[model samples]
Target: MKHNNKYERPKIVKQVDGLMNKVGRPALNKPFDKIDNVPVDELISNFGSPLFVFSERTIRNRLNDAKNTFTIRYPDTVFAWSYKTNYLDAILSIMHQEGSLAEVVSEMEYEKARRLGVPGNKIIYNGPCKTRASLERALKEGALIQMDHLDEIAEVEEIAKSMDVKPSVSLRINLDAGIYPQWNRFGFNLESGMAIHAVKRIVLGGILKLTGIHCHIGTFILDPLAYKRAVEKIIAFEKELESKFNLKLTVLNMGGGFASSNTLMNQYLPGDQAAPSFAQYADAITAPLLSVQNSYSRKLILETGRAIIDDAGYLIATVIGTKRLVSGYKSIVIDAGLNLLITALWYKLQILPAQTYKGVVEDTVVYGPLCMNIDCMRDAIPLPDLQKGDKVVIKPVGAYCVTQSWQFIKLRPAVVLIGADGSVDLIRRAETLDDIISAEILPERFKS
Candidate 1:
């Protein structure tokens, strides 16, 4: 039997101790050509390279799964879409359509939510910094203000007094949830008596009504038991608050820190295998709430953002060049960079070939098209020989990349949403030179 052979240029290779030879190695390349049945090539041709593609079906399904997972365990579960995670109007609209309240961390995010038709009452206003004007507007609109410090309480009280309205607010508590690097910066400290002191001050002020309690342990939390500990601490504090002030809280906001299925840079296993499922998180959270539900029913508000949106997003980039380093290692450069995919710093995002190929898999270093050395995406990844003009899909970037992305050497790319019915919509258009300098004003002398 005769087999067809392709000619190739032979290169010298360095032999490393205990390393397997590349010969006879099975090709690990698999084509990821389409997103929701929409061809990747078609998308890049219609839009451009380095495009952001989101699956509307994935977003809805993930949100629905989260809602169902918690609602079945506890009927009072409420989901608030964390705006800081990915505040793209289209994403927010989808979240709102799926019945998620807006959870904002800043005045800008709060305004964005309001502009999207989410009433002030439906907005969960959080964060360490809240301006006077925003606070006033939120109070007037009956927003759920989560007070971060005693100063915010004073500010809110003053505003409430001026408006002649007693706004029901929630206190953000920061506690030692048996996790490393405790997040005690944003909220009142629980162990240091700061939380109790803040509560006392709120009650003593008598200007604002304290109706709820909120806490966010940390982001990308892997341990379910950590949440269990947080819930236990919150429940205990709630009891103390109720007993001391004869005030029963109505809402317990276990803030968003849910881990998405994107592998952390330091993780040994992939995110999907290591991270807890929605069911596990629901059980850990609802178990404690269910135990005390008989005494007083409380609305459980979950401001989960990453877990629901991360896996739905994909970044389609084009390979521009390939090279061999001094150490005889292969390197591939793509069009997308740290400017467009900021989350690449924290996540070891999976990169897949857009077309099927038969080639030897090598440990290749993936670099972004940037002059800076820090623009490298993957330090070392096992990938087949990727040539110029080849398309690659980098994924699970639906959470923070867009929200945190900024324009640097290159303008930002366009983002499109592939709907459940295979319809494509351009949610955000690619940035142009005018878009970058539109707000800039040249000096009179310079203009002349």
Candidate 2:
């Protein structure tokens, strides 16, 4: 008989009633070697480790599914890509190609959309702080400015008078959607009669046209019933606007808060199981709009961001070293940190080994290379034994990671887009030392 010589680490097992021990369960040893049919090793070799990868196919498919799901029921549904979600030029270009319009929240974002060749009429300008110059520019360029407060109505009227342009605007109304922690900071409150008051003020002023009503309840909302309540309230308001002021609203903007398939830190179930599907949300939102009595045709705008782009993005990090903690638990340090993957602060992101591994499964804490103690990625996860120079893949990061990433202890890495045809293209290059200090100014007095 041949003697087996495989080495395995010794670990004490604690048995609990009605709970299967991880030691007796199958190990998560399956290798995640490829992304969109492209090998992970080849990507790291070409773009270097700690890279961001996006799948073009995944984005298109998700967007198409969302469009079809909503349009099939509403028919007048329009998708305005939320720039703040993931505003890469390539990502925006893809959205534009798919017939989506631009939804911007700041002057910089509005300018970026313009530079990308998106027409002014196609842009939906939204936010609380719209500078005087930017508001004037948006008015002149035909952007749909969604007013957030009563003061903004007067400001828009002033800008309209100066530019001699009759800008059709939208009002963002916040209401009680049966959800906790209501987002009443940005827009007028509907339940308190503030929304109706604002509408009357705008209609009576006659300087700006109130052609639309918008509402954004909250972010990452898991309950579809919240949207139903918001829509019902919006329809009631529309009825009041038409009956009292004879103002017929042509647009209904339901600002996006659809949850993405990324598990929240305190969630009881995984994201895929907890997050509501696009179909479920569509069913909840469209039912109320369809029940309205008015015969006037209205365009419904959805400003979804994370749901369409989150799962399409990925992060590949290389393991720098591994160590055993003082408590006998294992830990591994990767090249990527909180700077690159800030969403890790709220999301329990999924991490998988880039290559195959076989050994004892242990609870490991994945940490970033940053010297800060808060650079921990995964606090405790059951993972196979990982060694130095190994690679790991963190996923569903395609939404806010790239835009929110900053230069902290390490420079940001290159980002690549994998096309449907399996061709890879570099969307963003890695940061260099010169890139970081190019805008700095030094005084001659400080020079040696």
Candidate 3:
């Protein structure tokens, strides 16, 4: 990777009253003293290196921030927890406790939602692929099954034919948000008139009842106008559906793409640097929807995954080694790898030395303890001096990191939830060798 030679990190000075340093970036006040008292050191010593910690306060605050934004503007709003974002039971349960319904895409997610005590009626099932059994089961359970394609529609129709009751359905619409190469695979095309055709088929098909129209333009959207435009186009189609077919739309699901605070490496500033907060997203989505006039008022449903969880999660790792390159620059390697925190490989995350920021900054690279050359955390980071055995904290990773982690060459790390009272408890135990090999059995003659 080529480093940006023109880039310069500002010299930061802390103020007693406020958080900004000379760099204007919000400096993180070291919480190690408070954190250390919680037995994190004991847990790490017992559980080993590379730990994942979640703050219950952050999760509740972020969720309330997102929920309050929409509730202030729109009368009828429902926030569905996007299960694929971070599906840890503790995380999902926290969201559920905060009144979020489940937004699932697959059978596993649907079952997970069921396990979490979310009634089937509260679950919104979306995705391109669905098995016949899955569709039948979702139908039987009265979950909101979103139609992805004609084949899925046929599958649902076949099951509905044998069942005693008809199924409730929603059609996923693909809109040209005037951005991207266009997403045509997951949903029916709105501009090409395919979506209208599908709606008519579902209305006339007799096996399924169309309850809503759903649209998801894109993911990690930086511009608020993109959502405004998408909402306008979506409402226009809702109008056409109502006028043309006399259908009363019950819900309009503008699917999740709200960008999290983790900035992409290619981005000029970090995602938290200029990325819109949860309130901004809520406003961008609901404003256009509320402006539209409808015969039957529609409930605005949001399947937000990343923005809800990203700020609440933190990955804590210990510095395992330090090295000086042939070019005489310092580098730090940690025990955590891309196998556990995939976002670190893509997002140039802001790394802070937990207890030690000695005001000395250097251009550095952070690497993970992986054999692959590609398993790097940050290529060229201007960070404070770090020593081996010192702790480092990477923030705003409460979103897709845990859900997307891979077990490539290492076991995943344990996840601990820090409560409001400052007590810590293990939510997920770190993987064990027996846990890994329990599913496998060797024949006596073929044992290695």
| lDDT (0 to 1) per candidate | 0.90, 0.91, 0.81
Residue range 232-351, candidate 1, lDDT tens digits: 999999999889999799999999888998999999777888999999999999898888857337999999999999999999999999999866789999999899888888888888
**Local distance difference test, candidate 1:** 0.90
**Which lDDT value does model 1 have at 49?**
88
Cα-based TM-score, every candidate = 0.94, 0.94, 0.90
RMSD of each: 5.3, 4.7, 6.2
lDDT of 2 by residue, 1-448 (tens): 9988998777563322234654344335478889999999999999998999999999999999999999998999999999999999999999999999999999999999999999999999999999989998899899999999988899999989887877899999999999889898988999898998998899888899889989989999999989998898888888888899998899999999999999999997778889999999999999998887652388999999999999999999999999888677789999998999999999988888889887666678999989999999999877778999999889889988999999997899999999999999999999999999999998999989
Q: After superposition, how far is residue 379 of candidate 1 from its true place, in Å?
A: 0.6
Off by over 4 Å in 1: 1-29, 293-296
* Deviation from native of the Cα of residue 104 in model 3, angstroms: 1.0
lDDT of 3 by residue, 165-245 (tens): 787789998988877877778889999999998998888888888988888888887877788888888878878887998
The TM-score of predicted model 2 comes to: 0.94
Q: Report the candidate with higher lDDT, 1 versus 3.
A: 1
